[model samples]
Target: MKKPELLVTPKSVEHIEDLISSGADAFIIGEQQFGLRLAGEFSLKQVNEATKVIHAANKKVYVAVNALFHNDRLEALDEYLMELQRIGVDSIVFGDPAVLMAVRELNITIPLHWNPETTATNWFQANYWAERGAKRAVLARELSLDEIIEIKENSQPEIEVQIHGMTCMFQSKRKLLGNYFLFRKEAMEIENRKENKNMFLHDKERKNKYPIYEDLNGTHIFSPNDMCLIDELTELFEAGIDSLKFDGILQSDDYITTVTNLYRQAIDAYFDQGEEAYEALKDDLLEKIEVIQPPLRPLDTGFIFKETVY
Candidate 1:
């Protein structure tokens, strides 16, 4: 099989065209933010439209139904998903078993890449889904680089891990943040004071609020350290992993340059100079933020190291 390519998804039709224009291996169209902000409407029409344009340019597209949905919302998801299938989505990312089973029931036939939110670790579980027609599993974010390598070696399925992006620090359930914006609307205003780092509070519905910290000093509010494996390309390839995924739904031009360039250089070094070249590029692989007008957080490699270096 060919080596995996880098993917950057614009958050919506309004902001992603520039990103699509910039060169990337593919576009994971229809990110989580697309419909929620569209004034009481949500649909995969954006992905459908994006796929047509991207196909014309000869780039790949993956639609992400990548959110944690309540049981009440499954029916709506099913209907939208049918449209995705009819539109000829290259691949669709999903985590809910109900969603998975529903899609399969219709024999949609498109590849279903398991989203990490479902949190299925262990190779056997991955293969179990593969037999059921899942094309790949986007491994859990909590995994170490070694664990990721192990998953690739042991899992019978093709494994893809996030190579770069912001992450939620909590366990993968993502159910904890069920706190609604309607309940207390004040959390967004507190910014990041010491006493108010996490401003969200519990509401009458019994759902706890997700605090939005304004840590002026660094990345805050459920931000995971960015994963930049630019120079580590050979190690990931040698580990037998299939894809190196990048996170963030349409953000900035700098995001495009910093991420894609690093991987491009890393992949080239792998074939040209091998490990020695890779080692040299590893040092100072990150570019200084110059000015984090809002001041971003320092990075965390998460559990990627052999031991928990972070």
Candidate 2:
């Protein structure tokens, strides 16, 4: 099996060098106004600078324009895409079919990485995207290992999976956070009360809570625990995944460095010495991840083992 490319989300230009040094083979840089992570968005100038940095290390950079676009934004989107193509961006990751069509219509030739943001659960979906000019498909986080293996076996496009990071459980375009605060303004002393900076939601029925955040795309409710697949590198490699992605846009630089290094070590160990070495390093890697991850954030295997309920 070919060794999977190690992809990482670098929130800023400052993180690019460290990410490259940490063994990242490629990066997914968020667009300033059109990416999922508003907090991690980069200006066009920053994107240009970041691309230079990533290319200097001989690694690739994929710009994230994965937000669903509206009719009003089509002109701007076309212009932005042309600008990206001019700057030699390696690829554009997008979720909207209209945007993909726009890219094609504009004759923008940078490869597309289709991230439908939901429901890329099978090989047929991957093949569908491949037939439509997508070079890669970021698989949905809801699939199990066996399902992923099946998709890899049947798909035509290169497969990418989020091996470590937050799993978004819910996403909506409405400004829920703003509306909530507005509605509650009269219920309490609005002006004097501090906004709940550390925002989260507790599910009474599920007896769990998840991190919540709002941005240009809307409100996102993430899974209760961050996904940690440090122990499953061998499975992913054997399954023929083309890339393993680390999502750290919302995490600290130290956290990104530690997790990236852990995965890097695990991937290198597996490819060089085989499964036994990979297994032997699991505990040590997990310990390090725990140490570096935010104290309050929990880690779990995510939906890799069990199917997510509909």
Candidate 3:
């Protein structure tokens, strides 16, 4: 089987080299205004600079132009796509049709990875975008293992899945958290709300505390446990997944690099020696990841082993 490309979101432009050293084959990054849930924002200049650096290392860079746009925001987007093309990025990850329209109107040639998050669940949806020009389908995190395999087996575009890091559960354009604080007349700074990594919403019924924060995209919430699919890598690779993404949102650079290296080692082991090598290393890798991950942010297989809602 061909080895899957290991993709990661860098914490910042400065962290790109470290992530590259940790064995990341490709990176997904963008400014906050255009990307809904990014680890950090990069100016267009930074995107140009970083793209050069990535290409120098013989790695790929994918810019996120995946935000839902307003009429006002649409004006700047066409130019942005053109600039990205000029910089020669490997691909653009997009959710909104406006981005695709802009690309076509500007005659931009950069490839697109369709990442509609929750909505990209089945083969028909995957092919619809592929037929329109998306080169890859970043499947929904909610898909069960069987569903993911089936989709890959039938879908025309290459498949990408999140193999590690936090999973976003909710997002909104309204500043819900800030409004709540305002309702209570609490004295909270806007920056505090934007950078509040300690904030969470507790679900008493599920007994889970979802990480929550507000940003330019408004309010966003994450799953209770970070998704760690190290154990399931074999299945994904064997099934012909083209890429595996590791989100670095809400994680320290050290943590992100460490976790990435662990996966790197595992991927190399599996491909170099087959399933038996991966099996022998799985237990030890999981133990290291358990110790390395933040105490509050637990790890699980996400929806891979769970039943999907119809």
Name the top TM-score candidate. Answer: 3
Which candidate, 2 or 3, has the higher TM-score? 3
Worst ten in a row by lDDT for model 1: 33-42
What lDDT would each prediction earn against the true structure? 0.59, 0.83, 0.89
Q: Could you tally the backbone clashes for each prediction?
A: 8, 0, 0
TM-score of each: 0.74, 0.93, 0.97
State residue 125's C-alpha deviation in candidate 2, in Å.
0.9
Model 3, range 75-187, lDDT digits (tens) per residue? 88888888999999999999999898888999999899999898998999999999999999999999899999999999999999998988888889899888887888874
Error (Å) of candidate 3 at residue 237 is 1.2
State model 3's lDDT.
0.89
Q: How would you order the candidates by TM-score, starting with the best?
A: 3, 2, 1
**Candidate 1 TM-score versus the reference:** 0.74
Worst lDDT 10-window in candidate 3: 187-196
